[model samples]
Target: AQSVTQLDSQVPVFEEAPVELRCNYSSSVSVYLFWYVQYPNQGLQLLLKYLSGSTLVESINGFEAEFNKSQTSFHLRKPSVHISDTAEYFCAVTSKTSYDTVIFGPGTSLSVIP
Candidate 1:
């Protein structure tokens, strides 16, 4: 089985400041990592993902996450944040054997203050 863990439940940051959301996972087999964001009253949106190829993957929205196999970590980082970035972030993992089944973390609430 695979499980995702987010170290922080809430992160408060000022606008234009850099932030990092820590995520760790444990799995017996190979798995894919993903980060999703949910706006107020909105559905989950795919932020970024690490499936294969490079260990580092980036999103179109200035968010980047590196897949560290040894540490089993895939931490999300943004060089600068905006007030619009405020949302609930989730770290998820899905085993290679079952791509359709995804396990999500408790979720991290990012509060970007202007």
Candidate 2:
């Protein structure tokens, strides 16, 4: 099972500064990881995902996430956030290879104080 220590309840950041959201994962041999971000009053959005290969996001609004095995951490980095939008981000993972699989965590709701 993969798990994250979870970031602060609400992360405060400046508009033009870089922001990093850190998440730690358990040393599971095979797993699929995903990031879901939901802005205030909006539906859940897929920020990025790591299933088998290259961890960097190809193209997603200048947002990039990487899964590092050496450091055993997953980080979500953005060059700079231009808006002060409050968001609810969740970290989800599964220990299955197929698309239709059951998730493991109890689910987490993280708030970003932009």
TM-score of each prediction: 0.97, 0.75
Residue-pair clashes per candidate: 0, 0
Clashing pairs in 1: none
Cα RMSD for candidates in order: 0.9, 3.1
Off by over 4 Å in 1: none
Residue-level lDDT tens digits of model 2 in 1-114: 446555544576777677676766674666667777777787887878887778675326676778776776666677776564347666666665566453433334433334
Task: Kindly give the stretch of ten consecutive residues in candidate 1 with the minimal lDDT sum.
Answer: 93-102
- Candidate 2 has its poorest 10 consecutive residues by lDDT at 104-113
What is candidate 1's TM-score against the reference? 0.97
